[model samples]
Target chain A: MSNLKGWKEIPIGGVIDKPATSRLYKTGEWRVSRPVIDREVCINCMQCWLYCPDMSIEGSIEGKRMKLGEFKMEYCKGCGVCAAVCPVNAIVMKPESEFIDE
Target chain B: MPVKLTVTGAHAVAQAMRQINPDVVAAYPITPQTPVVEYYATFVADGMVDTILVPVESEHSAMSAVVGAAAAGARTMTATAANGLALMIEIVYIAASYRLPIIMPLVNRALSGPLNIHCDHSDAMLARDSGWIQFFTENHQEAYDFTIIATKLAEKENVLLPAMVNLDGFITSHGVESFEMLDDEVVKEFVGTWNPKYSLLDTENPVTFGPVDLFDYYFEHHRQQEEAMNNAYEELPKVFEEFAKISGRKYDFLDLYKTDDADYIMVVMNSTASTAKYVVDELREEGKKVGLIKPQVFTPFPKKEFQKALNGRKGVVILDRAMSFGKEAPLYSLIKSALYEVPSRPKLGSYIYGLGGRNTSPKMIRQAFEDAFNDNLVADEQRYLGLRE
Candidate 1:
């Protein structure tokens, strides 16, 4: 909280200067499990992208085909709605401690 | 040129609203306060003013709609009393937290339990800590004058807080009085146009209002509001000076009547102040050294001015219309806290008077003052004036 500016420095009326600035809080630390997507079994269906509560998942479209983009770890609060909505079992929620950097 | 007119306090407020001609007015009708909106609605219907009058279904919706309009960068106002104000309590806090600068005329009435509707200070006292600036008016003239002044003060760049001008219900709201009213053009010039520093409608410089402020930033935002309130206290005299230049009617945080060489003093608010003045004059003619301190601005508590006026008095009595129930009355407690540090503070007494529009005459006021003078120094019990056993 000390990192945030003092009362005098903040915008009048508590208005955020930039949209989607909640990403500055690093809410990903609250997540117990992280969602990982399997590209091979992924059927270009944007179900997970649509269901992501934090808008942390971006969809990458090549020409007429759409695929999953990189997950934004900064904003993901570990809500598993995206994993529950994936029809093809392409996305899985894995324990954060068990997962090693690839 | 200012002209004299005989009108109810509610109509005087409506007349002020017409002169201001705000961008929006969202209101619901409650007794006493009903005519204020009714008259404004006629102005809107007859093409007298270019204001979007929203005759909202309830006071809650009225306040909510006004909040939205004010946030959208439109000058807005509303009027309500007692139960209507009670229903709007939730949004009242929201409006102040957002610093919307909305002006409201809160017609004072008794908050009901057994359901009685008349004049009292309970309604205004309920919102005392809601972070809105409050002004208590003695008559229709101050009611009209303060409404316009409240608009300018609320919209000041340094002080973007909501404000409420309180006129006693039925006593002043329904009673007609003749008072000088400023010309429309002169009022328009005095209030001027509202230039919001940041607005929700400013697409080019977008801003978010009423955001979820958690532990990290909520305190800081509250501090900002405190700073704004402090700024309002400092900015009020300047605003009063400017208004006086045009209208020749000066005002201050507190109105002092014969406090210079007085040994006994009475402090009160609203229309009761006028009654106290009559008592004070009569006491003076009989060679009694008594004075009166009528607090005009209730919020920000006007601590400094009150301390200066009350220091070195022999005895002081405070009259409160609302009961704090289980504790000291609101105005009495406020005065005690304010004068706590005064070097030779006066012996203070508290009296609860005129609840539910009980008649408070000059004789009753004089008796209270006499009781305060004769009471023992250490006695601190509250006396209920005119309350039958």
Candidate 2:
């Protein structure tokens, strides 16, 4: 036990070690294209959640009213499925390279 | 009270399993391994244990069920032999990678095609690189003792890795031998309840299992498995010491019989070591300097110990029941590598013996010793015993 090296102390395996892994892993970086939802037109149908592969869509409810649907960009893989399934043309897939300066 | 029972290796291991009395036993019956699951099934049916005996359809499912049940934080065990292991090999890797402490009792047998189902190490050798602790037992007594030891060792939090307790097919599995059993209550207290660190059933935590990790994280996770393996190797002696306190049988990485001052040494594992020991004893009585080294743990192989033990010997013979096919025998290759750093290392002899369950008599074993004495052995050349020209 005394001779064990620090690298040999890693408790790693296939299971997820952290909670709210979305915050721990910024999966949005994987996106070549990002989904930008136009809140003005979002009907809060939560259609994005219905079609999201990673279920990266979220909407908070307030005062008995559902809020506008927002993309959890940290986890959205930019598959554009949410844009494709939106009932209205409220969500658009934008080139990720355009936002690289920010 | 510890009662001495004359039982076959299969039954002996089952007795240990009954003591460990894991939450799940999901083995598919195969050849020499059948009797282990059979006896365990009887324990389940007679209500001696609270285990859920899952009668899985195939070896693949058997291991899959084990992995799944283990994920749910259940203490799990399974047994298999030969092709059944070959079938379950894929998930066997998954169980280890998941860091599940599943103890499997593997009956050592030849792998198929011209299919023979008797004693050999081919089956155990197949999983050599599978990142699991491996225990090679020489007889029914060892098979029994190591099963208990493997349970506690595998479940250690820092050393959470699966393990295989290997015994030769029919040779140990069917041959009756006398073994003393630790009382169930004592064994129960010794191998205390498993409190898993990662439980799929922990709904409050809600963490992913067997999740996909791309190249970015996969390599790190693999490195962690290596660390866990090292942890097992480092921490194992403590468990062995604890077992010794209750059982009074001190265990070591290698069983070095007459090795300290011998001129010639033979290295073997599992049941073959028994025959090799008999031959060593005979040669010693005849005023010859012969010794035998049987490795108890195959994985995390004791390289330093081998280097020290065989450093100044006259000649060394490594008898492997499994061949590497187009390469030197597996055990031979490992021992040869272990000797590379020692300047005073003995000249090595590689011998492949008892393939597909061929008979390895004491006379056959003596012939290998005779080759070592005459220095008729080349380090690179492979000789055979009990094989026709």
Candidate 3:
């Protein structure tokens, strides 16, 4: 097996040294628009979690004890499932077009 | 003789594709690259060309479909970038090894993580060793012209290798510029019909491709690939000479600009070379004796031509837009090896700039040129362009 330490030096000769930036600003990229939940309308239901195609939705399945709906944008491919499954219409799928006019 | 219209680099490439009139195209949708296929869809929808456009679910399937189409004696083409090309990796090797002569436009983009979908050469860098003849276009005009030449070069009987034509992701893909598009009849005559000796669908004779090469014949398959790559050195110029006769734009594997008497030079590829050209012009105006060397054909990398351009140059600076994960930037290592063959080589080093859509400005190019002039300064890390800390 090759030593992993020399591998770091390899990219050093190749890697573009990145200037520091706020984590949030650094993460800005062209991403699929996804949905967020309104805590008021969520009733500890897991309908969106069951229907996600990429298994992007992550939340608890506890019965009536935990917060019903919450999803991380990191893994979400913006398939708009949470908004589509919200019984109270609390979830809204804002298309990425709103933020990026392009 | 020339008609000019403003169009995006993707549209320019699509215009060239329509002109060449390939029999089949299998393309997939990916960020920054979706525009190329989208415009081709418009061309097909408008009934401008009679071509089979296969809408594939994934890049792998897209390449597989093109491989099938090309093997059946059809001139086939495809477009993808970054993760899309990564997805097509397995079949890309198969296409080159099989000598199917499929031409693909790689709208180069950064690979994911914190998940970026913008411009970078990460995808192309990862693919350098994949046995395909790669070419990098620095502008919309070359992006359009190279596609026509690529079809002829890849289809040549002596050099039957898949060609990867790379354009900067968001920069060239979406950047609109005026380009001179060749007429359909001219391009059709330039490329001609792709006549392959061994085709899967040939009714006259049946042959098995992608056969199980049980170690005995596997090395021969790779040997054939190597031979084909070497043959590309002659085949590229032949096709380019033919293209120049019709299009009037002569091309070489490596384009030398003002390097005849310069002591120092900067080498680059892709769209960033356009900015480097501007820097070269400004430096020349100040009598600083700077020039830019850009590569039009990457794989079967024009070793002889590259060394000639570096001749008499005291120091050489290679600018690569992509970073190899566990090695020196692909361009740096490749240039180092190329220089090794020369008798009196220049001081060679590299600078990696513009990953993840970072703007590579002319100002940065000037600074890099100035840095290369200093003998005392040994730059440790690759220079980051447009980084605001």
Provide all candidates' interface root-mean-square deviations: 1.6, 6.1, 19.6
Cα lDDT, model 3, residue B300: 84
lDDT of 3 at B258: 87
True contacts kept of 2: 0.57
- TM-score (chain B only), all candidates: 0.98, 0.99, 0.96
- How does each model score on lDDT? 0.89, 0.89, 0.79
lDDT of 3: 0.79
Candidate 2 wrong stretches, greater than 4 Å:
A1-11, A27-102
lDDT: worst 10-residue window of model 1 chain A: A21-30
TM-score of each candidate structure, all chains considered together: 0.86, 0.85, 0.77
Q: What's the number of clashes in each of the models?
A: 0, 0, 1
Put the candidates in TM-score order, highest first: 1, 2, 3
| Winning model by DockQ | 1
Clash pairs for candidate 1: none
* Clash pairs (backbone) in predicted model 2: none
Q: Give the TM-score of candidate 2.
A: 0.85
Q: Which tens-of-lDDT digit does each residue in B23-82 have in candidate 1?
A: 999999998799999999999999999999998899999999999999889999999999
DockQ of 3: 0.01
lDDT of 1 by residue, A10-92 (tens): 88776775666754665655577888888899887899888898899999889998878988876887788988999999888
Task: Tell me the docking grade of candidate 1.
Answer: acceptable
